[model samples]
Target: MVLFQEGLRIKMKDLQNTLEDYEQVKLSCDHTAEYIKVQSNNTEKQIKEDFEKLHQFLRDEEAARISALWKEEGQKSRMMKEKIEQMVREISSLSDSIRVVKEKMGADDVSLLQNYKSTLERAQCALQNPERVSGALINVAKHLGNLKFRVWEKM
Candidate 1:
Protein backbone atom coordinates (compact mmCIF):
# COMPACT_ATOMS: atom_id res chain seq x y z
CA MET A 1 0.00 0.00 0.00
CA VAL A 2 2.87 2.49 0.81
CA LEU A 3 4.67 1.69 -2.44
CA PHE A 4 1.40 2.24 -4.25
CA GLN A 5 1.03 5.65 -2.66
CA GLU A 6 4.64 6.57 -3.57
CA GLY A 7 4.10 5.53 -7.14
CA LEU A 8 0.93 7.60 -7.35
CA ARG A 9 2.79 10.66 -6.01
CA ILE A 10 5.50 10.26 -8.65
CA LYS A 11 2.89 9.98 -11.41
CA MET A 12 1.24 13.16 -10.17
CA LYS A 13 4.56 15.03 -10.21
CA ASP A 14 5.29 13.79 -13.71
CA LEU A 15 1.88 14.98 -14.90
CA GLN A 16 2.46 18.40 -13.39
CA ASN A 17 5.86 18.67 -15.06
CA THR A 18 4.37 17.61 -18.38
CA LEU A 19 1.66 20.21 -18.08
CA GLU A 20 4.23 22.91 -17.34
CA ASP A 21 6.35 21.83 -20.23
CA TYR A 22 3.32 21.85 -22.50
CA GLU A 23 2.53 25.39 -21.50
CA GLN A 24 6.12 26.42 -22.21
CA VAL A 25 5.90 24.81 -25.63
CA LYS A 26 2.73 26.62 -26.39
CA LEU A 27 4.26 29.94 -25.40
CA SER A 28 7.31 29.26 -27.55
CA CYS A 29 5.09 28.38 -30.53
CA ASP A 30 3.12 31.54 -30.14
CA HIS A 31 6.30 33.57 -29.96
CA THR A 32 7.62 31.89 -33.05
CA ALA A 33 4.41 32.65 -34.97
CA GLU A 34 4.48 36.30 -33.97
CA TYR A 35 8.16 36.54 -34.90
CA ILE A 36 7.45 35.12 -38.34
CA LYS A 37 4.60 37.53 -38.90
CA VAL A 38 6.73 40.52 -38.00
CA GLN A 39 9.59 39.36 -40.15
CA SER A 40 7.29 38.76 -43.11
CA ASN A 41 5.81 42.23 -42.83
CA ASN A 42 9.27 43.82 -42.72
CA THR A 43 10.38 41.83 -45.72
CA GLU A 44 7.32 42.87 -47.70
CA LYS A 45 7.87 46.54 -46.94
CA GLN A 46 11.51 46.32 -47.93
CA ILE A 47 10.67 44.64 -51.22
CA LYS A 48 8.13 47.33 -52.04
CA GLU A 49 10.61 50.07 -51.23
CA ASP A 50 13.28 48.53 -53.39
CA PHE A 51 10.94 48.20 -56.33
CA GLU A 52 9.68 51.73 -55.89
CA LYS A 53 13.21 53.08 -56.06
CA LEU A 54 13.91 51.13 -59.21
CA HIS A 55 10.68 52.30 -60.75
CA GLN A 56 11.42 55.91 -60.00
CA PHE A 57 14.83 55.60 -61.56
CA LEU A 58 13.35 54.04 -64.66
CA ARG A 59 10.76 56.78 -64.94
CA ASP A 60 13.42 59.48 -64.73
CA GLU A 61 15.56 57.70 -67.28
CA GLU A 62 12.64 57.38 -69.66
CA ALA A 63 11.88 61.07 -69.41
CA ALA A 64 15.47 62.00 -70.12
CA ARG A 65 15.65 59.70 -73.12
CA ILE A 66 12.43 61.04 -74.59
CA SER A 67 13.62 64.59 -74.11
CA ALA A 68 16.86 63.82 -75.87
CA LEU A 69 15.08 62.08 -78.72
CA TRP A 70 12.72 65.01 -79.19
CA LYS A 71 15.62 67.44 -79.17
CA GLU A 72 17.46 65.42 -81.79
CA GLU A 73 14.34 65.20 -83.94
CA GLY A 74 13.86 68.94 -83.77
CA GLN A 75 17.48 69.67 -84.63
CA LYS A 76 17.64 67.22 -87.53
CA SER A 77 14.30 68.39 -88.91
CA ARG A 78 15.48 71.98 -88.79
CA MET A 79 18.66 71.08 -90.60
CA MET A 80 16.68 69.33 -93.36
CA LYS A 81 14.34 72.31 -93.67
CA GLU A 82 17.28 74.68 -94.08
CA LYS A 83 18.84 72.43 -96.67
CA ILE A 84 15.56 72.28 -98.65
CA GLU A 85 15.22 76.07 -98.51
CA GLN A 86 18.73 76.46 -99.83
CA MET A 87 17.90 74.08 -102.71
CA VAL A 88 14.79 76.08 -103.57
CA ARG A 89 16.79 79.30 -103.65
CA GLU A 90 19.35 77.64 -105.91
CA ILE A 91 16.60 76.48 -108.28
CA SER A 92 15.16 79.96 -108.47
CA SER A 93 18.58 81.39 -109.29
CA LEU A 94 19.09 78.81 -112.04
CA SER A 95 15.68 79.62 -113.53
CA ASP A 96 16.57 83.31 -113.62
CA SER A 97 19.84 82.47 -115.36
CA ILE A 98 17.97 80.51 -118.05
CA ARG A 99 15.57 83.40 -118.61
CA VAL A 100 18.51 85.82 -118.99
CA VAL A 101 20.22 83.51 -121.50
CA LYS A 102 17.02 83.28 -123.54
CA GLU A 103 16.64 87.07 -123.53
CA LYS A 104 20.26 87.53 -124.67
CA MET A 105 19.77 85.00 -127.45
CA GLY A 106 16.67 86.77 -128.72
CA ALA A 107 18.63 90.05 -129.06
CA ASP A 108 19.99 91.36 -132.38
CA ASP A 109 23.35 90.19 -133.72
CA VAL A 110 25.15 93.35 -132.56
CA SER A 111 23.76 93.00 -129.04
CA LEU A 112 24.59 89.30 -129.06
CA LEU A 113 28.21 89.90 -130.06
CA GLN A 114 28.61 92.70 -127.50
CA ASN A 115 27.13 90.62 -124.68
CA TYR A 116 28.51 87.24 -125.80
CA LYS A 117 31.32 87.26 -123.26
CA SER A 118 29.02 88.04 -120.32
CA THR A 119 26.37 85.67 -121.64
CA LEU A 120 28.79 82.81 -121.93
CA GLU A 121 30.02 83.41 -118.38
CA ARG A 122 26.45 83.47 -117.10
CA ALA A 123 25.60 80.29 -119.06
CA GLN A 124 28.24 78.32 -117.16
CA CYS A 125 26.64 77.84 -113.72
CA ALA A 126 29.38 78.16 -111.04
CA LEU A 127 27.16 76.82 -108.24
CA GLN A 128 28.55 73.78 -106.50
CA ASN A 129 26.20 70.86 -105.92
CA PRO A 130 24.99 70.74 -102.32
CA GLU A 131 26.72 68.19 -100.13
CA ARG A 132 24.73 65.13 -99.20
CA VAL A 133 23.38 65.54 -95.66
CA SER A 134 24.80 62.49 -93.96
CA GLY A 135 23.26 61.46 -90.64
CA ALA A 136 20.55 64.04 -90.91
CA LEU A 137 17.95 61.65 -89.47
CA ILE A 138 17.30 60.81 -85.83
CA ASN A 139 19.41 57.82 -84.86
CA VAL A 140 16.82 55.46 -83.45
CA ALA A 141 19.23 52.56 -83.25
CA LYS A 142 21.48 54.36 -80.83
CA HIS A 143 18.56 54.94 -78.46
CA LEU A 144 16.87 51.53 -78.68
CA GLY A 145 19.81 49.14 -78.88
CA ASN A 146 20.24 46.98 -75.78
CA LEU A 147 17.91 49.22 -73.81
CA LYS A 148 16.90 46.61 -71.29
CA PHE A 149 20.43 45.41 -70.86
CA ARG A 150 21.63 48.93 -70.39
CA VAL A 151 19.07 49.53 -67.64
CA TRP A 152 19.98 46.27 -65.93
CA GLU A 153 23.64 47.07 -66.12
CA LYS A 154 23.01 50.44 -64.59
CA MET A 155 21.10 48.84 -61.81
Candidate 2:
Protein backbone atom coordinates (compact mmCIF):
# COMPACT_ATOMS: atom_id res chain seq x y z
CA MET A 1 0.00 0.00 0.00
CA VAL A 2 2.86 2.38 0.73
CA LEU A 3 4.48 1.76 -2.65
CA PHE A 4 1.12 2.11 -4.40
CA GLN A 5 0.60 5.51 -2.74
CA GLU A 6 4.05 6.64 -3.84
CA GLY A 7 3.29 5.64 -7.44
CA LEU A 8 0.03 7.56 -7.33
CA ARG A 9 1.83 10.67 -6.06
CA ILE A 10 4.37 10.48 -8.87
CA LYS A 11 1.64 10.14 -11.44
CA MET A 12 -0.15 13.16 -9.99
CA LYS A 13 3.05 15.19 -10.15
CA ASP A 14 3.54 14.24 -13.80
CA LEU A 15 -0.03 15.26 -14.61
CA GLN A 16 0.50 18.60 -12.90
CA ASN A 17 3.64 19.19 -14.91
CA THR A 18 1.80 18.44 -18.14
CA LEU A 19 -0.94 20.88 -17.26
CA GLU A 20 1.62 23.54 -16.43
CA ASP A 21 3.33 22.99 -19.77
CA TYR A 22 0.06 23.36 -21.64
CA GLU A 23 -0.74 26.54 -19.74
CA GLN A 24 2.63 28.00 -20.62
CA VAL A 25 2.10 27.16 -24.29
CA LYS A 26 -1.30 28.83 -24.18
CA LEU A 27 0.16 31.96 -22.60
CA SER A 28 2.86 32.12 -25.25
CA CYS A 29 0.24 31.88 -27.99
CA ASP A 30 -1.79 34.64 -26.36
CA HIS A 31 1.26 36.87 -26.16
CA THR A 32 2.10 36.22 -29.79
CA ALA A 33 -1.47 37.12 -30.80
CA GLU A 34 -1.32 40.37 -28.84
CA TYR A 35 1.97 41.28 -30.44
CA ILE A 36 0.54 40.63 -33.89
CA LYS A 37 -2.48 42.81 -33.08
CA VAL A 38 -0.25 45.69 -32.01
CA GLN A 39 1.93 45.36 -35.07
CA SER A 40 -1.14 45.27 -37.30
CA ASN A 41 -2.53 48.41 -35.72
CA ASN A 42 0.74 50.24 -36.20
CA THR A 43 0.99 49.11 -39.81
CA GLU A 44 -2.58 50.15 -40.52
CA LYS A 45 -1.99 53.59 -39.05
CA GLN A 46 1.15 54.07 -41.09
CA ILE A 47 -0.55 52.99 -44.29
CA LYS A 48 -3.52 55.27 -43.72
CA GLU A 49 -1.27 58.23 -42.98
CA ASP A 50 0.82 57.59 -46.05
CA PHE A 51 -2.26 57.30 -48.24
CA GLU A 52 -3.73 60.53 -46.89
CA LYS A 53 -0.47 62.36 -47.38
CA LEU A 54 -0.21 61.13 -50.94
CA HIS A 55 -3.75 62.18 -51.67
CA GLN A 56 -3.14 65.61 -50.21
CA PHE A 57 0.02 66.05 -52.19
CA LEU A 58 -1.78 65.12 -55.38
CA ARG A 59 -4.51 67.62 -54.68
CA ASP A 60 -2.21 70.55 -53.80
CA GLU A 61 -2.16 73.34 -56.46
CA GLU A 62 1.48 74.08 -55.68
CA ALA A 63 2.33 70.47 -56.53
CA ALA A 64 0.50 70.79 -59.83
CA ARG A 65 2.48 71.37 -63.09
CA ILE A 66 5.80 70.96 -61.25
CA SER A 67 7.89 68.16 -62.73
CA ALA A 68 9.90 67.84 -59.55
CA LEU A 69 6.71 67.56 -57.52
CA TRP A 70 5.53 64.72 -59.73
CA LYS A 71 8.80 62.92 -59.36
CA GLU A 72 8.84 63.44 -55.60
CA GLU A 73 5.28 62.26 -55.24
CA GLY A 74 6.00 59.24 -57.38
CA GLN A 75 8.97 58.34 -55.23
CA LYS A 76 6.98 58.75 -52.05
CA SER A 77 4.15 56.66 -53.40
CA ARG A 78 6.55 53.91 -54.42
CA MET A 79 8.16 53.89 -51.01
CA MET A 80 4.78 53.69 -49.30
CA LYS A 81 3.71 50.84 -51.56
CA GLU A 82 6.93 48.96 -50.80
CA LYS A 83 6.41 49.43 -47.09
CA ILE A 84 2.85 48.18 -47.34
CA GLU A 85 4.02 45.09 -49.23
CA GLN A 86 6.68 44.43 -46.61
CA MET A 87 4.15 44.70 -43.81
CA VAL A 88 1.89 42.24 -45.58
CA ARG A 89 4.77 39.81 -45.96
CA GLU A 90 5.68 40.15 -42.32
CA ILE A 91 2.06 39.57 -41.31
CA SER A 92 1.95 36.41 -43.42
CA SER A 93 5.21 35.15 -41.94
CA LEU A 94 3.99 35.78 -38.42
CA SER A 95 0.81 33.87 -39.21
CA ASP A 96 2.87 30.96 -40.47
CA SER A 97 4.96 31.05 -37.31
CA ILE A 98 1.81 31.01 -35.21
CA ARG A 99 0.52 28.01 -37.11
CA VAL A 100 3.75 26.12 -36.53
CA VAL A 101 3.69 26.92 -32.85
CA LYS A 102 0.09 25.85 -32.57
CA GLU A 103 0.84 22.58 -34.32
CA LYS A 104 3.65 21.98 -31.91
CA MET A 105 1.31 22.61 -29.01
CA GLY A 106 -1.41 20.38 -30.53
CA ALA A 107 -3.55 20.19 -33.67
CA ASP A 108 -6.71 20.51 -31.58
CA ASP A 109 -5.87 24.15 -30.78
CA VAL A 110 -6.39 25.36 -34.37
CA SER A 111 -9.79 26.84 -33.59
CA LEU A 112 -8.22 28.91 -30.84
CA LEU A 113 -6.12 30.73 -33.45
CA GLN A 114 -9.07 31.56 -35.73
CA ASN A 115 -9.96 34.84 -34.06
CA TYR A 116 -6.38 36.01 -34.20
CA LYS A 117 -6.16 35.09 -37.86
CA SER A 118 -9.44 36.82 -38.66
CA THR A 119 -8.38 40.05 -36.97
CA LEU A 120 -5.08 40.03 -38.81
CA GLU A 121 -6.89 39.58 -42.13
CA ARG A 122 -9.25 42.42 -41.33
CA ALA A 123 -6.37 44.70 -40.52
CA GLN A 124 -4.67 43.82 -43.78
CA CYS A 125 -7.83 44.37 -45.75
CA ALA A 126 -8.42 47.74 -44.13
CA LEU A 127 -4.92 48.84 -44.96
CA GLN A 128 -5.49 47.87 -48.54
CA ASN A 129 -8.70 49.90 -48.80
CA PRO A 130 -9.04 52.91 -46.55
CA GLU A 131 -12.37 54.12 -47.93
CA ARG A 132 -13.98 50.74 -47.39
CA VAL A 133 -12.46 50.57 -43.94
CA SER A 134 -13.86 53.94 -42.99
CA GLY A 135 -17.32 52.95 -44.18
CA ALA A 136 -17.18 49.68 -42.28
CA LEU A 137 -16.07 51.45 -39.11
CA ILE A 138 -18.98 53.84 -39.42
CA ASN A 139 -21.40 50.99 -39.78
CA VAL A 140 -19.92 49.17 -36.82
CA ALA A 141 -20.17 52.26 -34.66
CA LYS A 142 -23.78 52.77 -35.62
CA HIS A 143 -24.58 49.18 -34.75
CA LEU A 144 -22.82 49.49 -31.42
CA GLY A 145 -24.79 52.62 -30.62
CA ASN A 146 -28.05 50.88 -31.43
CA LEU A 147 -27.11 47.95 -29.24
CA LYS A 148 -26.28 50.30 -26.37
CA PHE A 149 -29.64 52.05 -26.75
CA ARG A 150 -31.48 48.75 -26.70
CA VAL A 151 -29.62 47.65 -23.59
CA TRP A 152 -30.37 50.96 -21.85
CA GLU A 153 -34.04 50.66 -22.70
CA LYS A 154 -34.14 47.16 -21.21
CA MET A 155 -32.56 48.45 -18.03
Highest lDDT against the true fold, candidate: 1
lDDT of 2 by residue, 128-151 (tens): 432221221123343344653554
- Which pairs of residues collide in candidate 1? none
Q: State the weakest 10-residue window (summed lDDT) of model 2.
A: 129-138
Q: Write the per-residue lDDT of candidate 1 for residues 11-98, one digit (tens) a residue.
A: 9999999999999999999999999999999999999999999999999889988998999999999999999999999999999999
In order, how many clashes per candidate? Answer: 0, 0
In candidate 1, how many Å is residue 11 off? 1.6
TM-score of candidate 1 against the unseen true structure: 0.79
TM-score to true structure, per model: 0.79, 0.38
Provide the overall lDDT of each model, using Cα atoms, as 2-decimal numbers. Answer: 0.95, 0.64
Please provide the root mean square deviation of candidate 1 (C-alpha atoms, Å): 2.8
